[model samples]
Target: MTLLNVENLRVTFRTEAGPVEAVRGVSFNLGRERLGIVGESGSGKTITGRSVLRLIRPPGKILADRMEFDGIDLTRADEKTMRGLRGRRIAMIMQDPKYSLNPVMKVGAQLTEGLRQRDGMSAADARKKAIEALEAVQIRAPERVMEAYPHELSGGMGQRVMIAMMLIPGPDLLIADEPTSALDVTVQAEVLAILDGLVRDRGMGLIFISHDLRLVARFCDRVLVMYKGKIVEELAARDLMAAKHPYTQGLLNCLPRIGGSQGPLPSLDRDAAWAL
Candidate 1:
């Protein structure tokens, strides 16, 4: 199923210096599969994700030829319509749980808020589903963990909680922005496995945005490599090593190899023409 179709999507911000273009003519289609957008910090990766939900506020303008989700036009949807779609139909798992989670609220209370508001479930049912969500992410002692506040949990557990909260609403599409950036390898793998299982079993679409070339290539089905506000290369994730674009090659060369030459890794060579 084609869940999202975007064409010529552009994002610009009104900075004090002048108008700055963040995304330029970006276009792609997302189905019931994993799509990864890989880029450096200033490559407009986050802006692209925010633009999809019209999260870009005043002073930031979004213009698009077409942006549709499940055959509904997203670009023209009113605030009320977009609000209903944001958390219920399309969810976003942000990078850090420290900032995303409520520090004052209990884990269980925060997790069940969406269920109570959107699904209109009774308190007992919402709490039951909340525990199941925590277990789905393989959290041990979920009942104890639910009573603890967000500040008391470890980094890995906090991240898993964030994932559970996002998935509890049964969204059709999930946009995870650097969901595993701070975790150790073991925890990262565990989180990815949980996400993959849910996507496979429920047939949900995922848009994973990150800067790690190797991880994206291994974990995603297709990849869009962004540079200077444009997609420099698009290919199957398995073929990342064989990418032909010079920018893509430069990024691949920057990755360190084990037991290879001991010198520092190569630096990326930026070309002015590549942005065009």
Candidate 2:
């Protein structure tokens, strides 16, 4: 059931100030279940997800003792091999559809581009599949949405479109990087529901990266808490409140609970040792 296995994974960028390690010695195994990576900004959660798909470019280096996906060695995969795996076997849903989708292309074109180019699907067949994908995400009037451009859709609609596109290929693993960060609470719930359904129905492994500790705890099966470029703790989602790490405990205490604490939320008492 283990879809991915990563050990001592490191992602570093050759900056003007010398090498900066964004992800340091992060290791985890993912099965066909939701795995949440939670942390504040610059904590390397996003980098860790991208490293699995070998998306790090030059100047940004990825190193690992072992990085495998479905028995294939990701650390040693060439660009061509990685390309085949990406989208087809391992799809990634970025933070924002506005930035991820092409501005100039229509929604239908954007959705079917991969199908036609990579899968060698014919135009009519690709269009039919694209419409089905849109429908699967609960987008009503799929044909109309497909004809519209990215700018023409609302935030929630655009996000659903993104989810639909990623699911079109029926990937085994889905890495969602703050997929609901920009949406309102209602929209966030809907998006989470869609993702949850995919995991339950399709048996797809999910790597959900987010800064919202509460949301991650609610939606994910297991949680990995990251801080200063490394995993601080890993625990079941239901046990998040009872986490043993000070970092996790500090994060939980920082959340402003309604009707519970009218006082100022506590800030993290930074520990130098947490990073080490």
Candidate 3:
């Protein structure tokens, strides 16, 4: 089944200079599969993800020909319906754990709170589920970690906690934006493994957004290459090496390979049409 579908999606921000389009006519479909959106910082990758949950704030407008999730039109859904969908049906894990989590709250409380929001279970039930969720993310001594505040935990631990909180509700779709950017290479791999396992085991759809073409090629089933607020190419991950788009090829060539001599990196020569 197609879990989510976006078509002709456009997003713009109101500014003093003029209206700036962040996402321009982007569209894609997601099933119970791992899909990666790869692009540089201002490619509008993150904005598209945020628009999925209708998280775009004031002064930012989102217009789409069709933005449907499981046959429900997200652009037309009321606030009440969106409230029930967010965090429960379609959860998002933001870029940085530090800003995503509440600094004053204990990890356990935050995790349990997410569970409560979805199921309205008893406090004890929520706590038990919290522990189980933490354990599922491979956190040892889940009980001890639960009692610690976000600041007390390391960057990796905090990210795992964020994952646990988002997964506790068993969301059907997970949108992760630059999820492992702050972690060490080893930790990033571990985290990615955990996310991959969850998607495989639970049959949940995943949108893994990042700038790392190599990682996306290795992890996602399909890849969407975005540039200047537009999707320039979409191809199967296995065939990424054969990508015909100049932007995609440029990104792949930019990755430093092991034992490769360090010299001037090849820059992407952008055409005027690519900016649109």
Candidate 4:
């Protein structure tokens, strides 16, 4: 049941200085499971996700020995094929809804647009599903919120709406790039729960990209620790503490513990040899 497979995936950007390799020879396979990618900024976490969707802009190039989705070779997929896959078979929920949602559009129109247009559902049916989608994400007053514009909803509500919009299409895979990075701890948990429930119920795959080690460890089935644009470690989420890679261990060590002795936080000690 391998939904997506990638091997020796390399992404380079044409910078003024020269070509910069953002992702170097990274590879992984995803099934109907939750896979978490964790790393600091510029560690290639976001770039890797974007590469899957072919979202990299000009001056950026994606190259892979093998990149397949559902038995189709993505490395050779043309724009037309990619368009059918992106947001249909594979959807991405961005880090923030404020930047993702349309500011001027009513939430109802935004949510039901896909269903009405793609699924051939009547306007009434689409509206019904849209409200159900909102309810699925635990929005209590979905009807009231439907009429409200994206700018009017709270941060958490806006995020839930984004999730509902993406899921309404029934995508096989969801790439959530720091979906709750902007929310509070409580809201983060709530959002993750909703995503987890939908993924499980619909038997869909998820690639969760985030910087929160603890959250990934708790929520994901497997964890991939990226450092310097490569996967330095891959381990079961429950066994994250037993990660053997130096980079992963160093990341775990940097977390500040509550009720523990307080002192100057330990700085990460990098080993040049680890990158090779």
Best by lDDT: 2
lDDT of 3 by residue, 24-117 (tens): 9999999999999999999999999999999999889999999999988999999999998998899999998999999999998898886576
Question: How would you order the candidates by lDDT, starting with the best?
Answer: 2, 3, 1, 4
Count of clashes in candidate 3: 0
Candidate 2 — number of clashing residue pairs?
Answer: 0
Stretches of candidate 4 off by over 4 Å are: none
Q: Against the true structure, what is each candidate's TM-score?
A: 0.98, 0.97, 0.97, 0.96
For model 2, residues 150-190, the per-residue Cα lDDT tens digits are 99999889988999999999999999999999889998898
lDDT of 4 by residue, 1-276 (tens): 999999999999998899989999999999999999999999999999999998999789999999999988988889999999988999999988898999999999999888887789999999999999999999999999999999899899999999999888889999999999888999989999988997789999999999999889999999999988889999999999988987888888888999866988777899998777
Q: Using TM-score as the measure, name the better of candidate 2 and candidate 4.
A: 2
- Whole-model lDDT for model 3 versus the true structure? 0.93
What C-alpha lDDT values do all the predictions have?
Answer: 0.93, 0.94, 0.93, 0.92
For every candidate in turn, the CA RMSD to the true structure comes to 1.0, 1.0, 1.2, 1.2
The window of 10 residues in a row where model 2 has the poorest summed lDDT is: 255-264
